[model samples]
Target: MDYYDTIILEYHNTILDWVIADKTTPIENLSVLDKGISDHSVITLEKQKPVKRTIACRNLKGLDDRNFASDIKKEAKNIKQLDTGAMLGAFNSNLRAILDNHAHLRTRTVTHRPSAPRMNEQIKEAKQERRKAERTWRKSGLMVHRDIFKTCTFKVKKN
Candidate 1:
């Protein structure tokens, strides 16, 4: 009798299609309540919809062994055989090259990517600037000093 019941009866087929596409089980019975207590009519639909899950992965490639081998061989030749420090340095340099190659493989080759500045160099520059600013502020009269008082308001009063 109400508008909701009329709409449900008219578009029952379309509603069924939406329910089916959403993986909701079809309702056995639909009822319209015309209880005189409430002004608005109540239409009850009984069904359960299944939950859906999605999965995604990043497209990343591993480092090419040929390039890594060539870099290691080139770096290894520069070291003198007799010196232990030179051999260790060469080994460290080769290891760095391999790590750099792997890092390149994980990142995307895009023109819009912004390069990051060296963190240690930036920190050193910031510390230098802070020291310079402090020196300048100390030379100026802006720095203030206050003496502590025994009867300060911040101290709690004893009963």
Candidate 2:
């Protein structure tokens, strides 16, 4: 893959941004963006890495609650204990064993997309606003647009 080391000349005319990736993961279209709002330019890159992950899912298509309860009852009858804690522990373990027997775990491979775990609806909308403001600021180069972009950036950082 061809990588572009383009720098944003408007921001101090120095390489203030970077996108580092491992040898296995090729970084494509690496460029520094001039948003005309922040002190440092934004670094953007497209890393084409097809991630395949196996996820274990329980199959409960034919599972019935009444059958599950009867199985639990049978398992409970076998557990002869005096201590309340030990009885509870045995109950939980037996419950898990019965569940596993009823609904076995099936592994399936799927492609995964990386995302920010902390990001929610509000943060996502704030980021969208920040990007829109950034585009407007870069296009018009006006103080008002820059101020709005800075406000949006601050909101995003605060979250």
Candidate 3:
């Protein structure tokens, strides 16, 4: 009927079965009423449950392909070493759940945000400049920041 009606409909479309994602979030927190009714009057919240994501390895924090391969190997070995099928299945499912967190680390990365206007043109230009500087630094064997050397895929030439 009104703007509130459309908003409630949109929410209903995404959240089927009236399930709240966060368990700690109380329904009463949303006490704001429009006119005399609520914006979420149509939303029937059943229960809120928190989501927890587990990472594969905490010790290995590098982007090198070797690290990824090793981490995967370590995880696989751990899974293989499990005595029971149920233990293996549980570990395997947990591994699959955190698939998004796993990534192949690239050598080139933007260290800082562009201090200029955040539009497409400015962002592109800034990225280009940063990349160029990194390339030059790599070729010339000149380190930009000493601490950044600790990151993935960086090898230092012993002088």
Using lDDT as the measure, which candidate wins?
2
Please report how far candidate 1 places residue 28 from its true position, in Å.
Answer: 52
Model 1, 44-125: lDDT tens digits are: 6775444444443333355566776777777777666788887797789777666665544243333332233333565565
Which candidate, 1 or 3, has the higher TM-score?
Answer: 1
User: Model 3: which ten-residue window has the lowest total lDDT?
Assistant: 1-10
Better of 2 and 3 by lDDT: 2
Candidate 1, after superposition: displacement of residue 44 in Å? 42
Candidate 3, 1-159: lDDT as tens digits: 111222122344445323333223434433323243533443433333444444443323444666556666767666644468877786677565444346432343234322333245645655555566566667777565323433322322210
Which residue pairs in candidate 1 have backbone atoms (N, alpha carbon, C) closer than 3 angstroms, thus clashing? none
Q: Rate the local accuracy (lDDT) of all candidates.
A: 0.49, 0.81, 0.45
Candidate 3: where is the Cα deviation over 4 Å?
A: 1-6, 10-119, 145-159
Ranking of all candidate structures by their lDDT, best first: 2, 1, 3
Ranking by TM-score: 2, 1, 3
lDDT per residue for candidate 2 within 56-110, as digits (tens), equals 9997877998999899889989999999999999989888889898998789999
Residue 21 accuracy (lDDT) in model 3:
32
Q: What does candidate 3 score in Cα RMSD to the true structure?
A: 18.4
Q: List the residue pairs that clash in candidate 2.
A: none
Show where candidate 2 strays beyond 4 Å. 1-48, 114-159
